[model samples]
Target: MSDVEIICDKSFSDVDSEILDRFVEFQQAIIDKDEAKLDEILTEKYELVHMSGKRQTKQEFISEIMDGTLNYYKSEIIDPTILWDDKERATLVADVALTAKVYGINGKWTLDTTVDFEKVDGKWYFTKWDN
Candidate 1:
């Protein structure tokens, strides 16, 4: 696999490292097609919103990944910003340029993505991915 360029804002702190790491792992899981890992990292109510406003539940997204309906070759995450809504809830916003095949279409697509996370039991889980 080729390298993925990830650029983040300078505002992140040591307290934010766990969230950042989990977010990166989530991206890598998509490229690696690691369904089990994705399942582990996502909340039970996780939803993935596409650029067109279509929403897919966690299971639906993982199914597509497993079947090759959604294939991620690589990604470059640019200017990621983190915003904490509370001590346990946070949002990560970024522009992600993705090289992939989606629903039989293949190309590099740049998307503005906002991912929400919630910390529970001292662990973070992805709650929503809006693009």
Candidate 2:
């Protein structure tokens, strides 16, 4: 039998376009409520550690986006910072703002979030986030 080796070689600093691409796709997914596309981008180990110290799984997170429960007129990332490690992992931190469509629904503002991504088999996947 031949030995099989898996290489995770995608570096984060060089993946600015990939990160931006994911952001664009994420924006489109949110705007269109495309759960499938959103699911594909998030890793199974995804977790959102909120500013208030709440943790949510990828499924739960996607559910919020898909169910219109967290109806955001516009959710955007601003002033992003990205870092990569030798373990084939990446991190992104950015400020975010979420505006609601209707009144009485106050929008949200948050400082930079810390997101961890793993480059598994060369494809980057969001694994964890903390604000």
Candidate 3:
């Protein structure tokens, strides 16, 4: 076989780092129950799929949070990996331990989570998440 060269380019750039930082902020917003900040960080089309196969739309989710129906006390993300499909779309996968009260049940859960983000108007917003 002839000599061949292969290039592997999977390194995260500064922009990607910034996006990851924003994601961490997003997690914090949930823990802090900051409705306004969550509003800014989540896209209008955001959706969440719970581990129990329940789904919530953006407004429904936000309303639950605002009403204290779904409260997040804390979240610790471990070994996050980010993959950008293009300039506008990215996926972040990580193992996370989260403490929360949902639907009147309070518990701590460790889960493997996949979060999707989209870039709109030069800003990144969380579009969806599932575990």
Candidate 4:
């Protein structure tokens, strides 16, 4: 028999206020290029569908952001709407823009975006990002 190990990468659970609060914090993290700060908000098991067409684990996502490989000089979330399905999961829709930047990219498409998130232990984490 072969020993099999499974890695858990489940989406976040359903929660509301915490989820939105974390979303705000996530925006801050992006601006600060903080890795550990972002990781602290995630569950041991998490998933990220990046806007740049990549799927990565929680660590991968934070590392890339903090490493300057994927730089986000200026960004903002406007007209945000949060939907909570439970105490561990929710979704958000918002309009964003880039106020400034250096070498990395800034600004999303002119259109709006929808992001789904999950909450655990009163912390919000992004589970999905789709345009």
Candidate 5:
């Protein structure tokens, strides 16, 4: 993620910064197609809800990206906002511009996304992505 540019609209607290770092890493994993890193970052029950209302389990989503059904070339996170439900749960909302190919369609799209994270045993893991 050293090559990626992440622009923040406002200053963040220490907790928020940590979450943002994890979020950036997750985006980097997708671009690099790093399955191991993805697994480490995402929870076991991770799910992704697509813009088309399609739902995919963790494995299914990873498989699609691996098989090129969903290909991610680049990503840029802009002005992310984090809302904490409690000390253990939070959601990050942002407009992510992604250059990719999805289900045969290729383009750069700005997606309004909400990513859920939960703290377990002092570590934050992504639980879901609602796009």
Candidate 6:
């Protein structure tokens, strides 16, 4: 019955904004079905774990998108919380509503997801995502 308290570093705002921007760009890439844009957003070692517990490498995920096995219609991110462990690494957790088709099955889903990012060469790239 007590109120909960949430705290994060104040200096994270700028970095969090940049990371959030990248996340939005990532979602847009899916909606646009732009493989090149996706490639640009993900790190070379990127991996994704779907809500169904399916795991994919960066190339596999991109291929699925390119071949229409996975199609994204919309994505809405809500209440994203970002934590920076250091200058080079951070984690973002968010509630997301997604409208999509996976392997020909169409559905809308709401999921709590986490994405890990790493800063390399002055840019943030997604390294891992789990939903």
- Clash-forming residue pairs, model 4: 13-88, 13-89, 14-87, 14-88, 14-89, 15-87, 15-88, 15-89, 88-119
For each candidate, the alpha-carbon lDDT, in order, equals 0.89, 0.65, 0.80, 0.59, 0.90, 0.85
All candidates' TM-scores?
A: 0.93, 0.74, 0.86, 0.66, 0.94, 0.89
Q: Root-mean-square deviation of each candidate, in angstroms?
A: 1.5, 10.1, 10.1, 12.2, 1.2, 7.0
- Selected candidate, larger TM-score, 4 vs 5: 5
Minimum summed lDDT over a 10-residue window in model 2 is located at: 1-10
Q: State the lDDT at 130 in candidate 3.
A: 89
* Tens digits of lDDT, candidate 4, 34-101: 77777776555666664555677777767777666666545555666676677566777766554434
Clashes of 6: 0
Tell me the TM-score of model 1. Answer: 0.93
User: Which residue pairs come into collision in candidate 5?
Assistant: none
Q: For candidate 1, lDDT tens digit of each residue in 30-130?
A: 99999899999998899999998889999999999999999998888888888899999999888999999999999999999899999999998999999
Q: What are the runs in model 5 whose C-alpha is more than 4 Å off? A: 1-3
Q: Rank the candidates by TM-score, best first.
A: 5, 1, 6, 3, 2, 4
* Model 6 TM-score, 2 decimals: 0.89
TM-score of candidate 4 to 2 decimals: 0.66
Candidate 6's residue-wise lDDT over 13-121, tens digit each?
Answer: 7878898878888888888888899999998899999998999999999999999999988887777888888999999998788888988889988878899999999
lDDT of 2 by residue, 1-131 (tens): 21111122444455865764565566566556778887888888889786668788989878876766655556566666667685577777667665543224566655466777777787777788787
**Which portions of model 2 show Cα errors greater than 4 Å?**
1-14, 101-104
Backbone clashes in model 3, listed as residue pairs: none
- Collision count of model 2: 0
Cα error of candidate 6 at position 72, Å: 0.3
Higher lDDT: candidate 4 or 6? 6
* Model 6 vs truth, CA RMSD: 7.0
* Candidate 6: regions farther than 4 A off: 1-12
